[model samples]
Target: MDPVVLAAGSALVSAMATDGWQQTRAAVVEWWRRRRPDRADGVGSDLEAVRAQVLAAREQGDEDTEQALAGAWRLRLQQLINEDPALADELRRLLDEHVDPALSDGEQPQHRPIIMKAEARDNSRVYQAGRDQHITGS
Candidate 1:
């Protein structure tokens, strides 16, 4: 999947759970309106339905369901971009301007790289990881 689509889809799903979802939703539907005016209304309705489902899944503590919803939206966005290659830039702008800012308002996410290394000698072995790890020796 395109990285912009992936990021936008994730940001869309995250925005749906935030108070600024309406703004993000409007921006999405407006973009659709410009591209395919006939489908814009339906797309808006569908977005609402998806948002409801995402919220319900989150309430039920169903991470898998939420992820599946995100994947669905990602695919939809990918299709749109496939049809009109120019929309890719618009999606990126939406992410940077609307969706991402909404997500960052409360608490910024933390990202850290993880590195792992292993070495073995004739009669000994070593295993290491910055986080989780599993190892077997003989």
Candidate 2:
């Protein structure tokens, strides 16, 4: 998937979990209104429905479901970009100016991949984590 699609999808999901989600949702809907007017009417309703699911999933401790919803959205965005290759720029702007800042921490895990490498030789040890790591026990 395109980086913008990945970031936007993940940020969109994160923002859905926040208190200011209505504004985020509205911004996305307006994007559709400008770029895909034909699909705009339904998009707001669809986003609201998705927001319900996101809340439900969070309540159920079902992060996977939330991720699946993001994937569905990513696919939707990818299709939009595919139809109009130039839309990628618009999507990037949406993600940057609106979607990402909506995140509580301004972090999009899917925005970039993390890779770690270590060579532990001669009684050495290596440990890595994308976020947090604790080594207890000497």
Candidate 3:
């Protein structure tokens, strides 16, 4: 899992401001730079791309994708907490605000695949990519 993603997850659990999210993302970028020095930007775009996709999905009224993204964020947050226990308190607080509400009502949305095309790619990849990945049918 991406450490930057983990940090983002932690932020979700803490109601972190947008600047906090950018800082966490920056740390992840730095870590990625250290690990893959030869890759130039070293996959910096992945996280930004994911963030953008999530925002776009929210704007599109894609509830299922939104929920799944939230779940993924939660998982990443858990991973971050496991990696650094000191953040537990912060994470717990965030969960109290963001996660608990969804759980109490069993309001997690179901995934609704929106496939636009199929060809060289297999169904499994399409499924794994989820709605966002399948939208372009690449």
Measured over all alpha carbons after superposition, the RMSD of each candidate to the real structure, in angstroms, is 6.2, 5.3, 15.6
> Across residues 50-86, which tens digit of lDDT does each residue of candidate 2 receive?
8899999999999999999999999999999999989
lDDT tens per residue, model 1, 1-138:
878888777778878888888998998898889989999999999999989998999899998988898899999999999998989888887777777877765432222235667779898967676667777665
Candidates' C-alpha lDDT: 0.82, 0.85, 0.48
Predicted candidate 3 versus true structure: per-residue lDDT over 64-135, tens digit per residue: 765566467667555655666666555444334443333323332232234666555454543345435435
TM-score of candidate 3 on Cα atoms, chains taken together:
0.36
Higher-scoring candidate on lDDT, 1 or 3: 1
The TM-score measured for candidate 2 stands at 0.77
Checking candidate 1 for backbone clashes, the offending pairs are none
- Descending-lDDT candidate ranking: 2, 1, 3
Higher-lDDT candidate of 1 and 2:
2
Best candidate (score: lDDT): 2
| TM-scores of the models, in the order given | 0.74, 0.77, 0.36
